[model samples]
Target: MKTYTCQCGTPLFFGNRQCVECGLDAGWCDVCSETAAVSPEGTCVSCGTSVVPCANRTTYDVCNCFVDASLAEPGTLCRSCGMTTMVPDTSLPANVRRWALLEAAKRRLLYDFRTVGYPDDQLTALPPLAFRFLSDTPDKHVVTGHANGVITINTSEADPVHRESTRQQFGEPHRTLIGHMRHETGHFFWMREIEGRRDAEATRLFGDADANPYAETMKQYYEQGPPEDWNEQFISTYAASHPWEDFAETYAFYLDMRAVLDTLRWNAPEQVQDLGDDLPSMLATYCSAGIVLNEINRTMGLTDLVPEVVPPAVVSKLQFVHDVFESLRTGVVSQS
Candidate 1:
């Protein structure tokens, strides 16, 4: 994402709630499509428009985006917070922090999702898109997944200790709350754009999701593990478990590429100056930038920022993903 400027001429960031230099409040002005200073009464300093700060700021301190004043009521939610249908029980202080972390990740995920031009309207049984942040209970165990347009994420993933342990258990190079959000939304969009719309093409590209028995596939995957040559054809080993997973995994990779490209454009324009819509150019530029980014992380003694290598077969799956996003951009769905 591009940097924003405060009224004080200090640089602001996507997650900034207040300008550190001037102490003036900062908010995401949806109308202006950038973070800007907002008055105490919720006036946009940049555009001189009226907006409503999301209630999550006052109630939970988890949001910084402003809602359009015209569409807002007494306690209106911003576009990002409004989609969160449920959150963890916040009576406990720990739960509140966990909810905060998940909300931050969700906002980032939705920001990138809408940035890619997908509409917020629902194409499934669930009204628009909803999220459920939950913790495991003795009677009801919650696994992170999507169904009928609703995405459920285990609240435990918010804690670094828990997330890193789970990542190592799965032998994942990287696992993150935003990664969970993107991967689950991939399933959400598959239901929206491809389940019945382009099943034939998706089957040819991945496999027949309907033909594969999902539960049995999951069971067998754990027992036998992924094929020894999984990396040759899949973006991740878990992606080789099922066709739906393959699509979601490849779709997540597509989002990761677009996000990195978007970041490079704003923060390092010279690197991606000639990048265009072509897949080859995108892959070339992305891999090129990844090498530099990964090395930078190594210098800091951190995990490689971008670990997965997009292989030839995975490229085919990503081609399918790109087509879906393009269709959404050009066809029925309009950007907000």
Candidate 2:
């Protein structure tokens, strides 16, 4: 989550479509790894790759990513949108906006993945990653989860009113489109990168993913709730529902903390440090910054921006996640 700037020096963000200072069209340059100005024809200035704005952007204003025309098939989607296997029926008026929100979150997740060296090609091959944004209809109930590398999300979660009500019903303290994308993609990556690797050690930390019947475990979890002492070891109550979920929830928090820390390092370098080797120090920096952010939200009559406390046990889980990410990134083991 590095801060980007317009060629003219105006600070930009990952999702910016236009530079406010230069009034030039802006987009993410996959080659340059930053938001840069796009020519009227949508070419990447640095790479000289002939690009086109994603189809979803042109048709539905849901994406800002550019597809490399030379690499993609004619009339095909950009890297992010191409991963979508299904979308809600566009004939329904509300579905368009909901799908847009979902796409925005997906693109953010993809951007973070790429920043961390998980390229789209590597992820979408073999046990490929894909998405289905579906709406619950009279005839079908859309459940959100990942299976066989495909992630499905219910579009109803995009509507704030509906989302808030459901969050309250489930007694969840925090819920967002981005959170759901990060959490579910965790499942896909776990299956793809760690599931059967002879040397992978996630099973030792999170418990065997295949040790129990997932459906029955979750059914009982929903009916009886997580163990009363769940907070002692799990990041969230839902995470205690099953081993796979424990991994996903911890993985999602790792992404969350890393993104926030990156932003802090960019904007407040004096207060943060480049202590990448010290996980405990990084978490302390995040918590210190989060307290200030929570105060700002309080002043605005809003909820805390980051509410969860990272207990010692949860920090150990996050450290394991970091080790796995490092192994995946560098193709070397971080620890025995």
Candidate 3:
């Protein structure tokens, strides 16, 4: 993710709602990928559009996106909120905050996608990436995953304590609402962009996409953990469970790497320079950044932010993912 700055020159974050330096309201300009100060009248100077806070923001305080009111009908949502197929019961105060956390993460994910040229409008038009923020009840346990372009996230994951406990239970060093979104959205993209057309290449890199006995596969995975040599090939133990998961995990890592590198470049352009084209060069830059970042985290008494070491095998898979994303961006691969 690139670092954004307010019109007042204060550095802004992806989720920033106000500029600390100037005390002005901030709204994301999708066209320019920057957080610009909104006029008191809620107009976007960059695009000259009459804008308003996204409905999700006004009603639930869950979003920071601004919609172009002239282009959209009355009560229309912004690009990110428009993609939500479901939201938790906001009548409950806890659910309201949980949904807000989920929406914040979702908006960041959408921003990253847009930065890579996969704008929400284009993505929604083709295969339609959507979301469902659900809460588990006595009768229904919400499992987080992607199916048919819809990514479902259990609202419980929004609670840091519960999320940490679940992460520990799964033996995962890194797991967050955004991480889940990135991983599941990886599955959605694979289905939309690569599944049938690039199955041969995907199978060669990950595994057979067609051999999907999902329930039995997952059952076996939980019954007996990943293979002893799993670390040599897969990004994580969960990734080793299935070919599809392997792809998604690797895809998520690719996004993570891209985000870290982009931030590093944005903060220190002269020192970081360009991340090279090849996988090895990119990994080298990422590892260096990870080392510095982990040390900073340690100072704060937090765990290593980017914990997993990328093996050669995983690097190969990342290369494939990067290529696929490039294909998607450039229309090198036919959507049909």
Candidate that scores best on TM-score? 1
- Candidate 2, after superposition: displacement of residue 147 in Å? 0.6
Q: Please provide, for model 3 over 176-230, each residue's C-alpha lDDT reduced to its tens digit, 9 standing for 90 to 100.
A: 9889988998899788877887888788989875686878888999999999999
lDDT of 3 at 161: 97
Q: Which order, best to worst by lDDT?
A: 1, 3, 2
Candidates, ranked, TM-score:
1, 3, 2
lDDT of 2 by residue, 1-336 (tens): 777766688887878878898787777765555667776776776467777667777788777777676776656677678789999999887999999899889878876785465645668687688999999999999999999989999999999999999989988877899999999988887777677862246766777767768989999999999999988889899899998899899888878877777777778887686545457877888788889989999999988877878888888878877767767777887763
Worst 10 contiguous positions by lDDT, candidate 2: 197-206
Colliding residue pairs in candidate 1: none
Clashes of each: 0, 0, 1
Clashes of 2: 0
- The total number of steric clashes, by the backbone 3 Å criterion, in model 1 comes to 0
* Reference-based lDDT, each prediction: 0.85, 0.80, 0.81
Q: What would the per-residue lDDT of candidate 1 be over residues 115-179, giving only the tens digit for each residue?
A: 67775554334545789999887898889999888999999999899999999999998899989
Inter-residue clash pairs, candidate 2? none
